[model samples]
Target: MVIRVRDLVKRYGNLTALDHLDLDVQAGEIFGLLGPNGSGKTTAIHCILSLLTFEQGTIDVFDCEMTPDAYELKQNIGVVMQNVAVFDELTVYDNIDYFCGLYISDKAKRKQLVQEAIDLVALNDFVKFYPKKLSGGLLRRLNIACGIAHQPRLIIMDEPTVAVDPQSRNNILEGIKKLNQAGATILYTSHYMEEVEQICSRIMILDKGRVIRTGTKEELKATISLGEKITIEVENLPSHILENIKTNPHIATFDYDDHVLVARFIRGENGLVDLLELMNSSHLQLGRVYSELPTLNDVFLELTGKELRD
Candidate 1:
C-alpha cells in the first residue's frame, strides 16, 4: 500500500474533525478523496502527512510509520496544496529552481530538473517573468511545477485545478496522467465530480470524518437506488400520464413541469422502452427525448444528503 490509516481520530476542543477514519491507497493508482466543506478531508490529509497530531490510530506510508521528522520518507513524497506557495520576488525559473534545490544540491543536476519542471508545466515562455505578471492559470502551473520538480514517488494534489481556466485545467489533468504513467502514485482531491470521474481509478467519499463509500465509479453507482434518468419534452404532460408513471413499479420517482417530463428508474429496470411504448400509444407529441445514465454526482448526492454544509 502507498498509504494506510486505521482508526484515525482527530478532535478540536469539542468538535471531532475525524472520527475513527480508516483509509487505504494502493500504488500505481489515482485515488480520489471527496467530501463536503467541513468533512474531515483536510484533517485526514494533515494527519497522514504528520503535520497535525491525532488522538488515536496509526498512519503508515510506504509500509512504515509516518512522523514529522521522517526526512527520508518525506523526501519521497511531494505535495501541491490548494493554496499557492511560491516566492513573489523570484521569476518563474528562479521559483522552480529554488524549490528543486531543497531536494537536490548538485548544480548541474538541479539545472536539468528545473528545466524539466518548466517544460512540464509549459512555462518556458514565462521563465523570466515575475509571478505578479503571470495570470492565475500560469501561476497555478508554476505552483505545480515547484511541487513536482523533484519528481517524488508519491504526489498529493488538493484542488490544483480550482479557479483556473478550461485550457489550463485540461493541461494540468493531462500532466497528472503523464506523471502517473511515469510511475508516480497520485492522491487527488477535488470538488469537481467530472474531473474525479475522468481521472480517478478508485474513489472514496468521506462524510463526518468517516468513510461513506469506497470503490470504482461503476461500483459506487451500482450501489445507489437510481438508474437511468429519462427525460421527455412535450407540449402538455397530462395528469393521467404522470400518475401512470408515478405508479409504475420500474420508476422510482417522477416529475413533470414546464412542459417536460422526467422519470427516474430503479436500478436494473428497462423503464425507457416501456415509457416510450406508453408515449407512442398515447400519441403524445414529443419534442425531445433523452436518457442519461446515473453519474458520479448522482451517487454522491444520494449517499451524502443534498443539505448545505458549512
Candidate 2:
C-alpha cells in the first residue's frame, strides 16, 4: 500500500476530529477521499502526512514509519493544498524551481525538472509572470506545477480544480491521469463528485470523523435503494398514465408538475421503453425525455442526509 492509516485519531480538545479511522490506499492508484464540510478529510490527510500531531494512530508511507522528522520519506511526497502556497514575489518558473529544489540539489537536473513541470501544467507561456498576474485557473495550474515539479512518488492534491474554468478543470484532470500513467500514486480530495467519479480508482467517503462508505462508484451505488431517475417533458400527461404507474413494478415513484413527468425506477428492465409505450398508447405528446443512472452524488446523498453544514 502507498498509504496505510490504522486506527487514526485526532482531536481539537474535547471535540474528536477522527474517530479511530482506518484507511488503506494501494500503490499507483488514484485514491479519492470525499467528505462534506468539516468531515475530517483534511484532518485525516494531515495526520497521514505527519503535519498534525494526532492523539493516536500510526501512518505508514512506502513501508516506512512516517513522522514529522522523516525527511527521507517526506522527500518522496508532494502536497498541493486547497489554498495556493506559491510565493507571490517569485515568477512562475522560479516558484516551481524553488519547490523542486527542496528535493533536488543538482542545478542541471533541477532546470530540466522545472521545465517538465511547466509543460505538465501547460504553463510555458506564463513562466515569467508573477502569481498575481495569472488568472485563477492559471494560478491553480502553477500551484500544481510547484507541487509536482519534484516528481515525487506520491502526490496529495486537495481541491486542485476548485474555482477554475471548465477548460482548466479538464486540463487538470487529464494531467492527473497522465501523472498516474507515469507511475505516481495520487491521493485526491475534492467536493466535486463528478471529478472524483471521473478520476478516482477507488473511493472512501468520510463523515463525522468516520468512514460512512468505501467502494468503487458502481459498488457504492449498488448499496443504495436508488437506481435510474427518468424525466419526460409532456404537454399533456394523461390522467390514466399517471394512475397506471402503480401497476408498473419497475417504477418506484414519480412526480408530475409543470408539464414535466419525473420518475424514479427500481433496477429492472428498461423503464423508458415501458413509459414511452404506455404514453404512446395513451396518445400523450412527449416533448423531451432524459434518463440518468445513479451518480456518485446520489450515493453521497443517500449515505449523508441532505442537511446544511457550517
Candidate 3:
C-alpha cells in the first residue's frame, strides 16, 4: 500500500472533522479523493502528511509509521497543494532548483533534475521569467515542477488544475499521467468531477468526513439505483402518455415540461425501446432524442445529498 489510515479521527472543538475514517491507496494507481468543501478531505491529507495532529488513529506511508520527524520518509513524498507555493523573487528555474535542492545535494544531478522538471512542465520558455511575470496557468505549471523536481516516489496533488484555462488543465492532466507512467503513485483530489473520471484509476467519495463509496467508476455507478437517462422533445405530450410513463415500472422517475420529456430509468431496465414504441404507436411527433449514461456526477449527487456544502 502507498498510504494507509485506520480509524482516523480529527475534531475541532465540538465539530468532528474526520469521524473514524479508514482509507487505503495502492501503488501505481491514480487514487482520487473526492469530497465537498469542509468534508475532511483537506484535514485527512494534513493528518497523513503529519502537518496536523489528530486526536486518534494512525497513518502509515510505504508500510512505515508517518511522523513529523520522519525526514527519510518525508524525503520520498512530494506534495503539490491547491495553492501555488513559490518564491516571488526567484525565476522559474531558480524556484524549481531551490525545491529540488532540499532533497538533492549533488550539484550536477540537481541541475539535470531541474532541467527535466522544466521540460516536464513545459516551462523552458518561462525559465527566466519571475513568478510575477507569468500567467496563472504558467504559474501553476511552475508549482507542479517545483514539487516533482526531486522525483519523489509518491505525489499528492490537491486541486492542481483549479482556476486554470482549458489548455493548461489538459497539459497538467497529461503531465500527471506521464508522471504515473514513470512510476510515481499519485493521490489526486479535485472538485472537477470530469477530471477525476478521466484520470483516476480508483476513486473514493467522502461526505461529512465519512467514506460514502469507494470503487472503480463502473463499480460505483453499478451500486447506484440510476441507469441511462433519455430525453425527448415532443410537442404537446398527451396527458395519457404522461400518465403511462409515470406508472411505468421501468422508469424510476420522469418529468415533462415545455414540450420536452425526460425519463430516468431504473438500473438493469431498458426503457428506451419501450418508450419509443409507445411514441410510435401513439403517432406523437418527436423532434429530438438523446440518451445519456449515468455519470460520476450523478453517482455523487445520489449518494451525497444535492444540498450545497460550504
Which pairs of residues clash in candidate 3, taking residues 3 or more apart in a chain or in different chains? none
lDDT of 1: 0.88
lDDT of 1 by residue, 1-310 (tens): 9999999999999899999998889999999987776788778888989989999999999999999998888888988878899999999999999988898889999999899888888999999999999999999999999989999899889888889999999999988898899898999887677788889999988777878899998999999999999999987777787778878999998888899889999999868888988888789889889999998778877887663122
Indicate which candidate wins on TM-score: 2
Can you tell me which runs of candidate 3 are displaced by over 4 Å?
Answer: 307-310
Residue-wise C-alpha lDDT for candidate 3, range 62-120, written one tens digit per residue: 99999999999989999998899999999999999999999999999999999999999
User: Could you say which candidate leads in lDDT?
Assistant: 3
- Per-candidate count of clashing residue pairs (backbone under 3 Å): 0, 0, 0
RMSD of each: 1.7, 1.6, 1.6
Query: What lDDT is reached at residue 278 by model 2?
Result: 89
Model 2, which residues run further than 4 Å from truth?
307-310
For model 1 the local lDDT of residue 3 reads 95
Cα lDDT computed for each candidate against the true fold? 0.88, 0.88, 0.91
